[model samples]
Target: MKRFGLAAFDDQQDDKEYEGISSAVLQRQNNELKEQLAVFQERLVGFAKKHNSEIQANPEFRSKFVRMCLSIGIDPLSLFDKDKHLFNVNDFYYEICVKVIEICRKTKDMNGGVLSFDELEKGYFRRLNVDMGDLEKSIDMLQSLDGGFEIFEIRGKKFLRSVPNELTGDQTKILEICSILGYSSISLLHANLNWKPFRSRAVLNEMVANGLLWIDEQADAEALYWDPSWINVLHE
Candidate 1:
């Protein structure tokens, strides 16, 4: 009887402790949500004021507003309650939505006209504080959306596409080396491989031309950086 009583007491204590931790986590999440909502509200208000006439006249604004709200884990069509779908969404949804909206708004403002897909992406990279190559996977996610953009080529130079995707196998390998070594220099990659140096350098050059890699011209010695999308594959 004594052991049984002690066991029950321990279980109760554990239950109480768990409940406390759970409560604390819930409270923290709620606070974060409140702060995020405040920022969203501020941005929305600014966007409204900045493009009052355009917003009012455009049907796309309503769709985008609803999408933005949904992305932020809120159902714009339903009552404004945070707990309605508590189990259905995670914190990342709200975080990413906030980031996306901020980027979109900034793109709209900076372009001084209707923002193109490429401009929005430029804004996204700037907001995320990531290099263009590092943002490829996240860019893929954006491309999956209805208005996703893609880059096009005119003459010999390539430009940003409204939509982007994962790198090809060879491109992936090149990016992997660049990301891992933090250098995309043709000579470096060639020396590192010690085999097929010229072929590898040519491929790297092609990738740069395709925007799968970027070069840092400001560096005293030029350095190549791979797109972040290839990081996972390289690790595997």
Candidate 2:
């Protein structure tokens, strides 16, 4: 029995020694990987600096560069230290943010601070010469300021909401129906959604008050509530 006890103690010691060796090996490998990543990042910073002019001047080049960095789990923007003017990509996105805000503010009355991504692309992106990725990044940066810049999807259609008010569930449902039919009337809501007449009317009226829905009193029957964003689509 004493011999057996000694044998067990030796086995435990061997197991602990194996674990220690495995841990040390893993730690060394992790350190080596981190060092490699650091070297790669430094090289990338150099490359970005060398081509800074092209990256800023050519949107296609900038997009490809940004995509390559992203694929490697790096943000090209991070290559620039806060004080480094020549390496700064933030300026590019900052300009986009300013332009987005200006467009939203100017069209707030026409679209009620809610514009479809398609409309935005058609009306501004071509002139601004930026891609959707750039606009999305600018939107993310603006979110920190809490200025109600957000993107929401209804029925797979994306719209930028520039207003501070959050959409209620009922309001969103109405919007989804509008996405399908281009307009929502009290009868349509009741027939399709099983909503009571007053419930449909109340939500529709509230949206009209918010400038989210335009009233078509000239419809053959009941007034139809329409999304202003669909006006262009209707014409097309």
How much lDDT does each candidate structure score? 0.51, 0.82
Question: Cα lDDT for residue 161, model 2?
Answer: 88
Q: Candidate 1, clashing residue pairs?
A: 133-227, 133-228, 134-228, 149-162, 149-163, 150-161, 150-162, 150-163, 151-160, 151-161
lDDT tens readout by residue for model 2, 119-232: 877878765456677778888898887767878898787788899998899988998999887899999999899999999999999999999999999999899999888888
Give lDDT tens digits, candidate 1, residues 1-236.
34565576677777899999999999999999999897986676566446644644665874575578678765442312223332222222444444554554554322211223333345344544434443444444555565544433323322333323434556545544554554566666666666475677677777666555655666666555554333333554
Q: After superposition, how far is residue 149 of candidate 2 from its true place, in Å?
A: 1.8
Provide the clashing-pair count of each candidate structure: 10, 0
For candidate 1, the per-residue lDDT at 39 reads: 94
**What TM-scores do the predictions have?**
0.33, 0.62
TM-score of 1: 0.33
Off by over 4 Å in 2: 1-87
Tell me how far the alpha carbon of residue 86 in candidate 1 is from the true structure, in angstroms, after superposition. 8.2
Q: Which clashing pairs does model 2 show?
A: none
Work out candidate 2's RMSD over C-alphas.
14.8
On lDDT, the candidate that comes out on top is: 2
